[model samples]
Target: MKPYNRRLRILCLLLPMLCLSLLRPVPELRADPSAGASTDDREILQNSLSVVEIDREIERITAQQETIQQELNKLSGQLEDKLLQIQDQQSRAGAVIRSYYMGEREGLLVAVLSAKDLGSLIHMYDVYDMIMEHDRTVLDAYQSEYKEIKNTKLAMEKKTADLEEMKSNLIEQRARVSALQQKVDQGIASSSDPEALKKMIEEFTLYWENVGLNEVKTYFNALASAMNDLPEFIQNQDGAIRTNGTTYNIDIKEDDLNAFLRSKNDLFKQFAFHFGEDEITASGQSGTLSLEVQGHYSVEEQPQNSIMFHVDKLVFNGYELPDTTCRQMEEEFDLGFYPQQIVSFVKATEVKSTDKNLHVTLKLSM
Candidate 1:
């Protein structure tokens, strides 16, 4: 008896069906109330699983396109090399021809002048004539070969161009797939946790201008610094460490870890907006949003001065906040917050250390 890998078996069964689904044009829906309900239900189904399917298709298509592009690029490079080689051969042939025919002393004249005796002069003339004839033959052959190579190169270039066009079309298709996937994913994410969605939007507004800042390189560097300070923070009660009064155990798996990273990245986008030296405006089919900081110092604004700040710690909703006397703002607004939910800039303090720069940790509602 063989062990069953259910997911693999389902995927194998659905492979053909999935391909068939892609071939059919999407159907149109009626606009009645019942039709609207059906549409909503269908949307939920798409949000749940269609987005993942679309992502898988996109990955497959993108990989195929990349492979094709690499092959086309290689063929184009080889064709270009062949063209250069042909041109070089032609140039060498031309130089040989010029030497034999266009020099001040022709081959015949040089041979006659160099020969000492009559028989030797006759043999030299014959040899010079034979050499010139051989050179002509070689030049003619090279020209013919060069022409052939040129024609072949043209054909290959046409083929490469066709492949590139095909790749471009495929890339466009992949973009469509990616956009659809994002829409479905967003819908699912929104339905699952509206609070988290709001947090993502708010954070995206913060460091929106710092697309470069969200790089893995910077993330890793920041993470390194944070990790290095962990020991000292854990030692002191006033330090950055937090304790739940009991042993804290997490139940996250690998997939959850990946989701956490994505959520973290989204959170990073929120921080990026806070550092906004300049306003960033992005408009998509779904919506338009803008992020800007009101200050004299604009980082991307190319201002003369730009303020730098570091986040010390994050405060989520309902946590024991430093300002115990302060009222919770979200409660007044009737907005509920949750764990891992990012909030707005509450009261912050400037680092009293040497630099005297400001550092803020956003306060969130749980």
Candidate 2:
């Protein structure tokens, strides 16, 4: 089916099934920071960049999955047809074997061998040639059919696996985005005094411009260094690993990451990161400031493949900053990464955080 046609069919039902979020009334703002989250507890209700962008990201992933599914279904149909072809080919091959065993083929061979005169021998040889031609045609067709089915099945398996992985990433993305949206809403709710909030946002923005990028990069660099600690994918650009397969996974334990980060950066000596099921939360003292950060890894396909870790929620010195501050910080800084040294070998496609580890998915390429 055409994409627009599927969209049209879905659109037809939109009126009947209105989204609950659309029906939701505007929420009243709460002045008490405790109403949403707490500053004393180091829980910061930081705002997010356009939540709509995250929504669009979800839609894009869903659409890509749907397209892959359609291809899988088409392959399934082709596989069915190929199976039928194989059955027909098998039956033809069986018939030829049965005829050969039943003496029809042997009779021709006997006559050809027993022929005495040149004329008789030539005639018998012609009959034998005709029989051989018939068998050869059946066998050749069967071989071709077998090859075709094998290729199709391999392609189907690859597509199925890719779809499943992408689906898992999609689910994780939705959960993380939902958490980010909640943070944004909470940030807005905590904005009791706009003038004071504006001043705080300005101060935070200035701080990020002056110090955040260097500190965050140092922290992120530490995380990247941690990737090397993983047993798998710890290879040179031209390493023997993943030579046959085009994709690989890197899963690092939470404790292992923390240990490596602290080792890499002394500022993170007291820092700790918790890789949740779908999000990453960290809090610690870097310099004299105690910072609490909420973030997630989002994959980017354009301008080269990379995973970007964004601080969608942040609390610096026990203040819940608004989206204005977060946006400026985000515009100037990016914390996530890919193995640049491996760019000659592979590219990262997706990432998902689990309670056990941060899972990065990469695809090998020239």
Candidate 3:
């Protein structure tokens, strides 16, 4: 063979292998069905787990605080009832005293004098002593109940103070956890390489084939068509032909378009393709297209055919797209593709720019 022909054949044989090497799973990407992860990747995962634990702790503390507040409210009501009981007792005592004073000042003496004999006078004196003794017993009971209520109120107030202190401490702890979480997040973000992140995002799309839902399968077919068609439309550069004879231009940078599609592979694995970020610009006669999507696949409890995907950040050309606009586009994409049984879900949360690249963090279900 000619030297030039031999060289060409060797190049052809090696090209596919080179491509395969580029597409093969990296150590960080081997999270599913295997236990191979680098130290940094494991640390990243640990940080994520720690964040979840912290969140759970915060929730538990909050629930406890709510219970304490309810107890305090119940105690307050009891104290009020006790106060009302004391007032009622005082009123009854005052009424009895007033009735006694209102009676004839010499009533007892008169009764004794009018008695038929000494035996009658002694009996009347005994009756008067019994009435005074009954009154004294009622007064003592009222005073004892008042003291008990006061003591109970003091105890309750002390408990409430203690609970308030506990709640304050919990809040401080929550704040500290939140700060740690932020630091971990920043570390992860800073350490991540955009190219690797993009590759991971692309790898995620392969999981769509694992979806068990027939409806989802159909929706994905349509979604794939729509996604693939966008690039074609841009590549054709022949304005989109309208029935009205007007052509709409769609100018898209090919490299950027490929980068955009590659960055969404991981997102597809997570069922969050709708929110994938467009690292390229596909500007046409219509409007610009840019997006950022984040999502995940789970066999756990989740709504069927429902993806919790959010476009947390988006931009079109130099202009930032409003959340509403981003959402509208997402809805339009769904409606335009699978109108019968909607499979994809999207929610736009915010618009922000970051180094003109799509950065995604992989989240694998364990």
In order of appearance, the predictions have TM-scores of: 0.28, 0.42, 0.36
lDDT of each: 0.41, 0.67, 0.47
Predicted structure with the largest TM-score when compared to the true one = 2
Per residue, candidate 1 scores C-alpha lDDT tens digits across 137-235 of 878878877777777667667766766775675576556656756775666466655565444433332322133112322443433344343223323
**Count of clashing residue pairs in every prediction:** 11, 0, 13
- Per lDDT, the best of the predicted structures is 2
Positional deviation of residue 345's Cα in model 2 after best superposition, in angstroms: 17
lDDT of 2 by residue, 1-366 (tens): 699999999887785567765787655322222223335222322333233334555786789899999999999999999999999999999899889788788788888999999999999898789879989999899989999999999999999999999898778768877886677556655667645554454444445435554455555556555545433334422322333367776665677667666766676677889999788988887544566778788888777677777777866545554443445455545555655454457777778998857877777766
Candidate 1 regions with alpha-carbon error over 4 angstroms: 1-40, 43-57, 76-88, 99-133, 148-167, 182-366
- Badly placed stretches (over 4 Å) of model 3 are 1-36, 92-122, 192-366
What 10-residue stretch in candidate 1 is worst by lDDT? Answer: 317-326
Give the better candidate number (1 or 2) by TM-score: 2
